[model samples]
Target: MWPYVAGFIGGLLAAGMAAAGESYWRRRRRTKWIPQELQRFFRVKDSSRLQVLQKSFPRHMAPDAKRGLDQWLAEQGLAARLVGVPITESFINTTGLSALMAPQGESWYQVSSVEYESFDVGGDAPMECPKHALWLLDGGDAKLALFWTYGTHRVGCNWVERLRIEAGFVMDSPGSGLADQVLARLEEAVHSGHAYRGQVLSLGGEDDYRGNASGVTVHRLRPVARQEIILPEPTLALLERNVVRFAEQRPRLRKFGMSTRKGLLFYGPPGTGKTHSIHYLINVLQGHTTLLITAEQIGSITEYMTLARLLEPCLVVIEDVDLIARRRDESGVGEQCLLNRLLNEMDGLRPDSAITFVLTTNRPDALEAALAARPGRIDQAIEFPLPDAAGREQLIKLYASGASIAPEVVASAVRQTEAVSASFIKELMRRAVQFHLECRPDAESAIILQNDVDQAIEEMLWSGGPLNRALLGAGEGREQP
Candidate 1:
């Protein structure tokens, strides 16, 4: 009886193992079989009775559009079926060119399934939903369907979608009618807005200039207020009139037969207010799209110009323009090529086009003559000179707004900071405050003393020697005229 029981137990264990093996094999077979099933569905031969509709979109948006499109189809009261195919590594490796091609005159192709997690409202664990290929059931009436797959184009690994509208014989001109409908939907989606609004977009990758056309890297920037900037009254007014006013009165300018397109150049010593003024201008023109191109991105200037044209009523801000637009003789062939492209884009723009180019440079003398010499290429060349005594006083007050600094102390500091840039005044105020806070950490409010301001200025000037003073816009070692 013991031997019989042992044998019976062993047989039961063997049967259980066999069932598990069978289940595993069945799953593997189904994994391989799905693409084939989709391919077969794609090759239906009754073209005379079927109408096809197709459209493609970027891969990023395909998955997002699925739910909305599915609901719309259901609301239309059509029998719709949606299937997702997973693009497993095994499938990609084994699939051949013949397997990917659609039947003659048909737009269907096998796509890999991707799985996304769906969450329940009760904070339950996520459930996996597989989506690979989309199918619209053909039951007498026309059906709308779409599928997502990798694009065949050489423009990098982008997602492509093929949308279809299949109707049985009742519709005449399915292509145009369906295309119009698709366009209308697309227009609505675009008008709804994009995720990159009010964000800075920089060129991405080395191939950006080589036609790889990968999208830009976005950066969110904090807006700088006008009062936060310290510039000469005339300089501020000039920018307000040309840059801000021009953008606002663009339509009016065109009405008066005036060219709305303008170019501005800001040149001065490093650490001056050129960049700060730009920040202020960006804030002032809040609604307008602004594209910023640094010295490193000069290679993709042409692409930036194209984008500026597309995003009209835009500002193209190029910092350190002298880096690329250097004196032609001093520049290499490549630099010259970039400079020419820059010149051509500026010159080619329509007079009435609502686009402005604001370029800044520290070394104005290094810039190409063609860029600055031409009247229309740069309508205004504003110099961001070292701040005057009054400007320095204002800057000190601005940066020290929260601190307890008397006006007399600021006036004295301004006298000592003659020929200093706005930046130096800012640093001077910062250091003075730091000394005050460190000494009076337990005080209700810190009062910045005259001694603190004097000490900070003395440290900056003497610590780094004359080179530091000159760099800080103190104009050290210059002949006192």
Candidate 2:
């Protein structure tokens, strides 16, 4: 009886140990789960949370973090606004904060705080005290802030403790570098210290400004292929500079108005890649989203201004702003308040915020003086004129090289053709491709012949009064020239 009792006890102990081992393995596997944005934000080299947080060291750390977080929230369709100045509508307390929901129809959520005692990776034992207090708000999505200082500054609270309080569950003393990273991201986000006014619309029609244009047709601009864009030396240089600006802007991308956004005015003849270039710029600028608006969307200056201020770090592309905001070649239209709103939106009081304005028109002289006078209103007034001889050659090469056209013959055809915009050339090439596909094996190779290109050009030149009249004549025939 004694031996039987002992055997049963030993068996029970062994079973308990086996169960404990399985539990440990299961916990390890579950801990490996990581959110996609978090993985991208930290560039997680290891599974440890400390290791992941430490690795996110982009130059503009704060903005980068905000962007990462914003993107995740946007994917979830949550509205996130970077609250700058404290607004009467945005309430706060010792534990959390809240803001008035924008774009309407969205409900508000309570802000809460969490204390993470060991988020830091190095130095003695990680600070066990509450490191920071975070403010979480719904902006079409969740936007969380780990602040640096919130309460009683005069007291003998160590800067490290303050940092911890600000950073929430993160490191206490993130140092200037880490602090800057976090601050840069939250620059546009409102805190208790800043001042804010009741947001008003400076421009936009009532329906759109009121967020009621559900079925409105928006001009969703698409980018021309890289091969199709003939980058002249000066334009190429500008493109490179824009790319650098975007790269430097990575961290501050979430912060509205950190650096003045550069707006390019593409004005010239129609089908000159003006619209297409806008899309190209968008593609080059990573993490940048383009919002295309027409004059119809903005009925007044007040509505437009309201939209611009409310939406930061957005590209407001106003196609034919000259129609509404321009001085108006036709007299009575000059007194338009819409122009005032656009000018203010572009070069208004809040120049430091993160909203960019892009306008394109065939006649730039039509724009109002007040609108263009603003120092940074039109950072780079690029004119997308008709392609020159060299530009034409490049266009031909881009269009025909994909096909089996003879290089020398294609070059000759390009030289023979009159000056045309990149858009026209693109149309010509597209037709060539279409014809080639239609006549595939029945016609020799799957290549567009020089003759086919020539025919396409001839058809374009003769089909319209403008192209035919212009090509037949010479001297000052081109608009820009």
Q: Model 1: per-residue lDDT, tens digit, 89-199?
A: 322222222233324312233333445533111112322223345554444433333443333333333322222222222235333343355445643443332433344
lDDT per residue for candidate 2 within 113-138, as digits (tens), equals 44332221122332222223233333
The C-alpha lDDT values of all candidates are 0.64, 0.48
Question: What does the lDDT read for residue 211 in candidate 1?
Answer: 28
What TM-score should be assigned to candidate 1? 0.74
Worst 10 residues of 2 by lDDT: 192-201
Off-target runs (Cα >4 Å) in candidate 1 are 1-25, 28-140, 149-176, 187-199, 205-214, 478-481
What stretches of model 2 exceed 4 Å from their correct place?
Answer: 1-228, 239-261, 300-311, 434-445, 467-481
How many residue pairs clash in all the candidates, one count each? 8, 48
Error of 1 at 342 (Å): 1.8
